[model samples]
Target chain A: MILVADSGSSKCDWVLINNHGEWVDKIKTEGLNPLLLSKKNISNTIDKVQHLLNKKHDSTIDKIYFYGAGCGSSGSGNLIKDLLYTTFNQAKYIRVEEDIIAAVHATTQEPGVICILGTGANCCYFDGRRVIQKTPALGYLLADEGSGNYFGREVIKSYYLKKLPLDLEESFEKEFGADLNLLLQKLHNVDSPNKYLASFATFIFKHRQHPFIENMLHQGIAKFIDSYLLNYKEELLDSPIHFVGSIAYYAQDVIKKSLDERGFIVKSFIKKPVGHLVNNIINKNIL
Target chain B: MILVADSGSSKCDWVLINNHGEWVDKIKTEGLNPLLLSKKNISNTIDKVQHLLNKKHDSTIDKIYFYGAGCGSSGSGNLIKDLLYTTFNQAKYIRVEEDIIAAVHATTQEPGVICILGTGANCCYFDGRRVIQKTPALGYLLADEGSGNYFGREVIKSYYLKKLPLDLEESFEKEFGADLNLLLQKLHNVDSPNKYLASFATFIFKHRQHPFIENMLHQGIAKFIDSYLLNYKEELLDSPIHFVGSIAYYAQDVIKKSLDERGFIVKSFIKKPVGHLVNNIINKNIL
Candidate 1:
C-alpha cells in the first residue's frame, strides 16, 4: 500500500492506496511537528501510528509521503525526513515537504493562489510543478492574518473590550475566566502558541454571524490579502485562488465575501490535502 | 485656599493654591474613579485628603474643583459630588466635571481637539464652554483608539510574531516570558485589563526609537485619527489640536507625526490638565 500523510500544527491525516490503484484506508493521528515535538515525542507518535495500523490492517505499508508543519525550511524538513526514515524501515520511499505543498497539490496547483489557514497560515503562488513565489507566514505572532490564531486573539480582545454581548461574555468568562496573565503564560511558556490561540477561534466560529466577529473576519481577511496575495497582484487577478483548512470549510461564506470584496474568485475549498497527494502518488507510478 | 484635583485611573494629583494664587502644596494619592472604586472607596480617598489637609493649618478648605475619570456621565458626577459633600463639611463649593474637560481646560479649550491617553483614552472637540461634539470613549475594549492600551496590545503581537529583533525579543521574553496564555489571563481576570495592557506600553516608551515600535505607534495613531478626528474633516482642519495625557506627553513625536501626515497642526502638548483647569475655573468665576 502507498501511504500519503498531511500533517498540520494540530493533527495529521493519512490516506492509503493499494497497488491496484484502489483506496485502502484513511485515518488520523495526533500532530507531529518537529519544531514543537522532541525526538522522543516523535518516536512515541510513530510507534502509536504503527500499533494502530497493525491492529486495523493485515497488508504491509510500502511507500510513504509525509508533508507537515515546521517542515517549511530545508533544515527542519531534513530533520523530519531523517526521523521518519529511522522509524519506518519497511517504507520503500519517503518524501517529506512543507504541508503547504500538499495543499497546493490537493488544489491541483492549476496556476492559482493556495492558502493554509489551520492553527497558523501560509500562502503561495503555485503553477502545478512548484511554488513560484511565497511570502513569510511569520507564525501567529507577527502574522497568521486569516488563520485560527488570528480568530482566537480577536476573541480574547473582544471579550476584554466588552464589545461582545453579555451572554457571550458570560460564556467566555465561565469557560476561560478572563484571566490574561494565565492565558499569556500558557501562550508563551507552552510549545504551541498557535494551538493555544486556535482554541479560542472555536468561540468565534460559534458566533460567526455576530457583527463583531464578522467585522473581525472582514478586517483579518482584508489584511491577509493585503499582505500576501496583493504582493502577487498580476498573478492573483489572472489565476484562480483556492483555500485548504478546517476554517475555510467552516467559514466559507466569510472567505467568499472577503474574496468578492477584493475582486478575486475562489475556485475551490478542500479541507484535507492527503487524498489529492495519494491520487498523485498512485497516478504518477502506475499511469 | 483653592483646591484643584486631577483624578485619573491610576492616581490623583492635588494642587493647593493660596489667596494670592501662589502654589501651596502638591500631593499625590491613589486614584478615585467611581466606575472602578466603590462609594466607600471614594469616601476613604476623600478622608485621606482631609486628613492630609488637617495635618497642616486648615481653616475650612474652600473652593474645591474636582476633575475625574467616569465623571463624564451625570450619574457618576453626581455620585462623586455627593461623596465630596459628605466627606468635607468646611468645603463651601465643589465643582465636578469629566476628566476630558480638565484636558480641554488644560489646553485652554482653544477651539481644537483634546485627547486623554492615560490608562484609557477619551477625546473631544472643545469650544471653551463645553464639548461641542463628542465621540464615544467606550473604555479600552470598544475604543481607546489612540491610547496606551492600544499600543501595548500591538507590542505584544509584534513580540509574538518575531517582528522584533533578537535582542529585543530576549529582553521581552526575559521580562514578560513567552507564555501568552498567562499574559492573556492576567489581562482579562485582573482588576483592570486597561491598566494591564497600558503597563506594557511603557516598554514601547523605553524603545520609542526602534523602527518596529515606531511603525506600531504610527499604525495606532493613524487608526485613531481615521476613526475619530478624521471623520470631522472640516473641524479638524480649521483648528489646532492639542493633547493632554502621559502617552501624548511621552510620545509627542509620534502624535505630531500622526497629525502632520494628515496635515493637521498641533497647538500645544500638556503633560497634566490641572493648570488649564485652574485657569478655566478662575476665568469662569471672574467672568
Candidate 2:
C-alpha cells in the first residue's frame, strides 16, 4: 500500500491507495506546513489521523508520498521526514515534494501549464515528466494573485472601504463580524494571517450572485492571468491549462470565462488533486 | 519645546521645534511599528535617538507628537506613548497618531485628498480639520497597490521569470545576490519580510531609467490610483491630490503623468513629509 497526500497552507488531504490503484481509505487534517508547524505539532497531527489507517494494513504500507507547501526547502522537508519516520517506521520508502509539483502531476500527464489557486497561488510549466519552467510565486504576502486568500483579502478591503453595496456589506458584517479594529487585530497580532484572511472566502462564495462579488472574482481571475499565467503565454495559450485548488474549482465558471476571453483552453479544474495523484501513482507503478 | 515625528514601517523622521516656530534639531531612526517590535526593541530605539535631545533641553521639552504606521489602534499607540514616557520622563504631554493623519496634515491644510506612497500605500480625504472620508489601506500584504514594496515585488517576479532585459537582470542579481533559493529563505524564514522586500526598492530606484523599470513604476502608480484614488472619484477629482513618501518623491514624473491623464491636479510631492508636518504643527499649534 502507498500513502498519498496533498497539503496546502490551509488544509491537507490524504489517501491510502492499494497496489490495484484503488483508494482504500481517505482522511483530512489541518494544514501541515513544515515552516509553520513544529515537529511535535506535526507528530500530534499524524497521531490524530492514524486511527483512519487500518491496523492490519499499517505494516504493509511500504511507501509514503508526501507533497505539501513549505516542504520545498531541505530543512523543512527533513524535519517532516524525521517526524514521519518516528511515527511510521514501517514505511521504509518516503518521498517528499513541493505542492506545486504534486499539483502538476495530479492535473496533467501531458506537457502544459499547471496553476494552483488555493490559499496561495503558484504556477509552473510542466512537461509530461517534470516541471520545465516556473514563475516565482512570492507567496501570500507579495503575490497570491487569484486565490481564496486573494479573494478574502479583497473582501476585507471592500468591506472596510464601503465598496460593496449596502446590503452586501450588512451581510458581510453579519458573517465575519469584522470591523477595522478587529480586522487589524487578526491581521497584525495573529500567526496565521493567510488563513485568517482566506476564511472570508466563504462569505464571498456564499454571495457569488452579488454584483460586487462577481466583479471582484473577475478582477482576481484577471490578475491571476496577468501575473502568473501570462508569463507562460506561448505554451499556456496552445496547450491545455490545468487548475487545481478550491478557488479554481469553486470559481470554475468565472475562471473559464476569463480564460476563454484570453484565448486559452482550461482542460481541467480539480477541487482536490490527491485522488488524481493516487491514480497516477497506480497507473505508472513507479513506486 | 515640541518634537514632531512621522514614521512608517521603514524609518521615522523626527524634528524638534521651539516656541518661536523655528526648527531646532532633526534626527532619523529605524522604523518602529508597535505591531512588529517588542517593548525592548522600541525602548532600545528610543535610547538610540535620545541623545539628539540635549540634556539641557530635556526638562524644557514639554511635548512630543508622534504619528506613525501601526499606531492606528489605541493599544499600539499607548504602547509607544508608554515607551516614550519612560524615556522622556520630563515630557508632560505625549501624543501618538496614525501616519495617514500625519500625511494629511503635512500635505494639506484645506479640504483635499492625501496619499502616502511609501513602503506601503494609503490615502484619505481631509476636511481641513479632520479626515472625513477615506479608503482603507490593507497594508503591504493584500493591498498596497502602489508602494515601494509593491514595486519591489514586481522586480523580484520579473527577475525570476527572466522577463527583465538582460542588462537589468544582471544588475538586479548583482545588487540583491538573490536566486530563487535565497529569495525563498529570506521570505519564509526571516522576520520582517516587509523590510526585506522593501530593501530591494533601491534597485528599482537606481535603475528607474530602464524602460522595464519605468513601465513597472507606471503600472504600480496606475494600479494605486485605480484601486485607491478612483474610489473617492467625486471628491478627489475637484480636490488637489497631494502625495508623500519615497516612492511618490522619486517617481514624481511617473506619478504626475498617471495623475494628469486621470484628470487630477497635483498639489505637491514631498519626499519627507516631516518638514511640512513641522510647519503644520507650528501654524496650527494644536499641541
Candidate 3:
C-alpha cells in the first residue's frame, strides 16, 4: 500500500493506493504545516483521522509521499517526514516535498510558471526538467501576495481600520461576529492562523462583486504579478502560467485581467491538485 | 514654561519654551512609542534624556505637549502621558497626541492631506481644526505602506528571497551582515522591531538609484496612495498632499510622480516636523 498526502495550512487530503495501483482509501484531516503546528498538535490532528486510516494495512504501507506548505522553508520538511513515519509505522521509504511539487506535477510538465494561491501563495518556474524560483518562499508572514491568507488579513484588517464601506462593515460583523478582541485572540491562540485567516474567503466570495472587493482583487493580483510573475520575463509570454488553488479558481476573472494586461497566458487553474497528482505519481511509477 | 515634543518610532525631539515663548532647551531621545514600550522601557528612555532636562525649570514647566508614533490607536496616549508626568513632575497639564498632528501643523494648517513616512507610515486629512483619517493606524505589521518600516521590510525580504540583483545582494550581505537566522532573531527578540526594521532605510537610500530600488519605491508609494490617499476622493487634487519624514524627503521624486499621475499636488516634504511644529505651537500659544 502507498499513501500520498497534500497539505496546506488549512487542511490535508490523503489517498491510499493498493498493490495494483488502484485507489483504495481516502481521508481528510486538519492542516499539518509543520512550521505552524507543534508536535502534539500534529499528532492530535492525525489521531482524529486515524480511525479512517486502513489500520490493517498501516504496517504494510511501503512508501508514503507527503507534499505540504511550510515544508520547503523549514530545512527540508523533516518534521512532517518524522511525524508521518510515526503515523504509518512501516513506511520503509517516505519522501516529503514542498506542496509546489504536487501542484506542478498535477498541472503540467511543460516549461511555464506554476503558482499556488490557496491558504498560502507560492510560485516557481518549471524548465521542463526541474524547478527554478526567482525568489525564496518566505511563508505567510512576509509573503503570500494573492492568497487566501492575504485576502483574509486584508479584509479583517480593513474592517478594523474602518477602511471598509459602511455596508460591507456591517455585513462582515454580521457574517463573522468578528471584533478586534476576537480577531486578536484567534490570531494569538489558534494553532493555524493561516487557516483561520483563509476562512474569510467565504465572506469575500459572498461580496465578491462589491466595488471594494473588486478593487482589492485588482491590487492583490497586481502584487502577485509583480512578485511572482514578472521575474520570469523570458517565459512570461512564451510559456503559459498555471495556477492551482481555491483562491486562483474563484478569482480567475481578476487574475485573467491582470495577466492579460501584461500579455501572460494562463494555461490551467486546478482547485485541488491531489487527484491529478496521484495520477501523475502512478504514471511516473515512483512507488 | 512649555515642552513640545515630536516623536517617531525611532526617535523623539523635545523643545522647551520659556514663559516668554523662547526656545530655552532642546533634547533628543530614543522613541517613546507607548504601544511598543513597557513602562520601564519608557522610563529608561526618559532617564537617559532626563539629564539634558533643565532641572531648575522642570518643576516650573506648566505644560507638556508630546506628539509621537504608536500613540494614536492605543486609547488616548495615556501611557506616555503618565510617564512624562512622572519624569517632569510638571506643575500642571500634559497633552499627548499622535505624531501626525505635528506633521499636520508643521507642513500645513490648510485642507491638505498629511502623511508621515518615517519609521512607520500614517495618513490623514487635515480640515484645519482636527485630523481626519480614512483608516485607523494599524502599526507596522498590518500597515505602514511607504514608510521606513515598509521599505526596510521589502528590501530585507527581497534580499532573503534572492529577488534582489546580484550586485545589490552582495552589497546587502556586506553592509548588514544579515542572514536568515539573524533576521529572524532580530524580528523575534527585539524590543522595537519597527525601529530595527526601519534601520535598513540607510541601505535603501544609498542604493536609491538602482532600478530595483526605484521599482520598489513606486510600488510602496502606490500602496500608500491606495490605502491612505485614495479614500479622500473628493480631496484628491483639490487640496495638496504634504509629507514628512526622511523617507518621504529622500523619495520625493518617486512620491511626486505617483501622486502626480493620480492628479494629486505635492505641497511640501518636511524631513523632521519637530522644528516647524515647535514654531506652530509657540505661534498658536498652545500652552
Candidate 4:
C-alpha cells in the first residue's frame, strides 16, 4: 500500500492506494505543519491514526509521500522526513515535498502559476516541472494575501473599526463577542492563530450575499492578483492559472470576476486537492 | 499628594504633585493596559510600585488622575479605577480617562485634532474642552493605524517579503531571526504581541535614511493620514493638529510633511505626555 498526504495549515488529507491505483482507505487528521509543530506533535498527529493506517490495512506500507505547508524549505522538509521515519518504520521509501508541488500536480500538467488560499496563502510558478516562487510564504503575519486568514483578519477589523454593515456587525457580534478581550485571545494566547483567524472567514462566507462582503471579496481578489499573479508577468499570460484551497473554491465568483476584469485566465479551482493529487501522482507512476 | 499618570500600551509615566502644583517625584512603569490585562495582573503591577509610591514619597496620596490606553470604554476605565483603589488605599479621589485626553491636554487647550502615535494609535477631536471621537480607539489588532505596532508590523513584513535592502534584511535577521518558527512564536504564544511587533520598528528607525525605509515610512504615514486624519476633514485644516507619543515625536518630519502637503497645520508633538499632562491638569485645578 502507498500512503499519499496533502496538508495545509488547517487540515490534512490522507489516502491509501494499491499498486494498481485502486483506493484502499481514506482518512483525515488535523493540520500538522512540521514548521509550526514539534517533532513529537507531528509524530502524534500521525500516531492517532495508526489503527487505520496499520491495523485495518494490514499490508506493509511500502512508500509514503507527504506534501505539506511549511515544508517549502529543505530544513523543515528534512525535519518532517526524520519524524515520518519514526512513524512509518516499515516504509522503505519516504518522500517529503512542499504543498505547492501537490497543488501543481493537482491543478495542471502544463507550465502555469499555482496558488493556495487555505488557512494560509502561497503561490508558485511551475516551469512545467519545478516550482519557482519569487516571494516566500511568510505565513499569516507578513503575508497570506487572499487566504482564509487574510479575509478573516479583514472581517475582524471591519467589525471592530465599525466598517461592517449593521446586520453583518450584529451577526459577527453574536458569532464572536463584541469585545476586545475575546479577540485578544486569537492574537496572544491561541495555539494556532492561522486556524483561529481563518475560523472567522466562515462569518464572511455565510453573509457572502451582503454588499459589504461582496465588495470586500472583490478588493481582496484584486489584491491577490496584483501581488502574486502580476509578479509572474509575461510567462503568466501564456500558461493557465489554477487555485487549490477553500478560499479560492468559495470565493470563485469574486475571484473569477476580478481576474476576468484584469484579463487573467483561470483554468480551475480544486477545493480539496487530495483526490486530484493522488490521481495525478498515480498517473505519473511515481509510486 | 496628587498622582498623575499617562500610559500607552508599552510604558506608563507617573508623576507626583503637591497641592500647590509642584512636582515631587517621577516614576516610570511597564504598561498597564486595563483592557489587555487581568485584574490580578493590573494589581500586581501597581503593587510592585507601592514601595516607591508610598515609602519613598512619605505622604498621604489624595488623588490619582490616570490617562491610559485601553481605557476609552467606561468599563475598562472603571476596571482600572477599581484596580487603582486596591493599590492606593489612602487615595481619596480616582479618575480614569482615555489616553487621547492626555494627548489633548499635553498638546493644546484649544480645539484641535489630538493624535496619539504610541505603542498603539488613537485620534480624538478635542472641541476646546470635551473630547469628540467619531470612531472608537480600536486596539492594536484591528486599528492602531500610524502607531509603533503598526509601523513595526509593516517593517517585519518588508523584511520577510524580501522588500528590504540587503543590509536592513541582515540587520533584521540578526535582531529578529530569519526563520519562520521564531516568527510563529510571536503570532501564537507571545504574551504581548503589541510590544513584540513594535520592537521591529526600531530597525526601521535605525535605517530611516535608507530610501526603502523612507519610502515605507512615507506610505505608512500616508495610510495613517488617510485612515485617521482625513476623518476630521475641514476641522482638521482649521485646527492646529497636535500629536503625542514617541512614534509621533520620532516620525515628526514625515508626518509634518505629509500633513503639510495636505495643508494641515501640525502644531507640536509631546513625546512623553506624563509631565505635560500633570502640568496641564495641575493648572486646570481638576485635581
Summed backbone clashes in each candidate are: 43, 0, 0, 0
Local error of candidate 4 at B150, Å? 2.2
- B1-287 per-residue lDDT for model 2 (tens digits): 88888889889998888879899888898888886666788889887767667743543767899998878778889999998988887888999998998998888788888899998888888877778545666677667877888888788877876678999978987888756666776775554666777877878789877888888888889988887888778887578989999989998998899888877888889888888888877888655
Off by over 4 Å in 1: A58-60, A283-287, B1-216, B221-250, B255-287
Model 4 docking category: acceptable
TM-score of each: 0.56, 0.89, 0.74, 0.83
Extract clashing residue pairs from model 3. Answer: none
**What digit string (tens of lDDT, one per residue) describes model 1 on residues B1-287?**
88889998777888887767667888888777766566887888889987898798566677788889767667778888998888787788999987887787777645887777777677788765658544545555335766877777777766754457887788788878887545644653454556677778888877777787777777888877766666456778677888888888887888888788779898888887776666666665521
Point out the worst 10-residue segment of candidate 1 chain A by lDDT. A133-142
- B61-104 per-residue lDDT for model 4 (tens digits): 88888988888877778889998898899889999998888888
Q: Higher-DockQ candidate among 1 and 4? A: 4
Top candidate, metric TM-score? 2
Model 3 C-alpha lDDT per residue in residues B171-287, reported as the tens digit of each score: 999998855645654654477878888888788889988999888888998988887777777865578889999999999999998878877789899999988888877788544
> How well is each residue in A1-287 modelled by candidate 3, as lDDT tens digits?
88898998888998888878889888888878776677798878765555567554453778888898868755538877877778767678999888988888888878989999999888999988798877666666567888898888888778866688999999999988854544554554477767787887677888988999888888988988887777788877678999999999999988988888888898899999999899887887643
* DockQ, prediction 2: 0.40
How much TM-score does chain B earn in each model? 0.89, 0.92, 0.95, 0.96
Q: Each model's DockQ? A: 0.04, 0.40, 0.22, 0.34
Superposition TM-score, candidate 2 onto the true structure: 0.89
Ranking by lDDT: 4, 2, 3, 1
